[model samples]
Target: MPATSSTTEFSRTGNGSSSASTKDIEVQLQQLREDISALAKTVAAVGNEKATEVKGKAKRAAADATDASYQMVEAAKSQAVSLERDLERQIRANPIQSVAIAAGAGFLFALLSRR
Candidate 1:
């Protein structure tokens, strides 16, 4: 073959190679875009799961606090009832003394208020 013919063949092959390389780059770019999209979706799902878990923990904490508060209120009510009963029993045992003490306290309160 002539030198010129060999040179032309080389030039044609080079052009075809460049075209194939460009097609390969385009395919790789499309695959990369797909991978990125899939990654984003995965990240979003994980984030949602974590958020749900945190929400559940918060709800459980709130319920526990409410139960504790309710128990405290019940305890306070029981204590108040016990105290009232004791006071009533003492007053009934010494009606005259209780009346005298109440009057003295009232007089002292009146004097303090006037000042």
Candidate 2:
């Protein structure tokens, strides 16, 4: 009867050591939850930083492409102006020869159009 009573009392109160262990488990669980929250916040901050970096890289790439196209257009305009000046100089140096060549081209064009 004494052993039965002791067992019943132990089961009801869960003994001093068991109760302390239970408290320790609860504390550990709470600490685990806080640690997980901190880790999630760290991950979000890193993601935001990466997103900002990618946006900056994209903007720089777009600006570089725009600058390259502008340079190409300027080069084309320069070349066209140079070609026009060269053609004028050639015509002025040999006006009679230029006139003869022009006449021959006109004759060939007229003949082709008739065909």
Top of the candidates by TM-score: 1
For candidate 1, give the lDDT of residue 27.
Answer: 100
| Model 1 spans > 4 angstroms off | 1-15, 111-115
lDDT of 1 at 109: 100
Candidate 2 stretches with Cα past 4 Å from truth are 15-27, 95-115
Candidate 2 Cα lDDT to native: 0.97
Best by lDDT: 1
Per-candidate Cα lDDT values, in order, are: 0.99, 0.97
lDDT of 2 by residue, 17-36 (tens): 79899999999999999999
Scored by lDDT, model 1 comes in at: 0.99
RMSD of each: 3.0, 4.0
How many clashes in candidate 1? 0
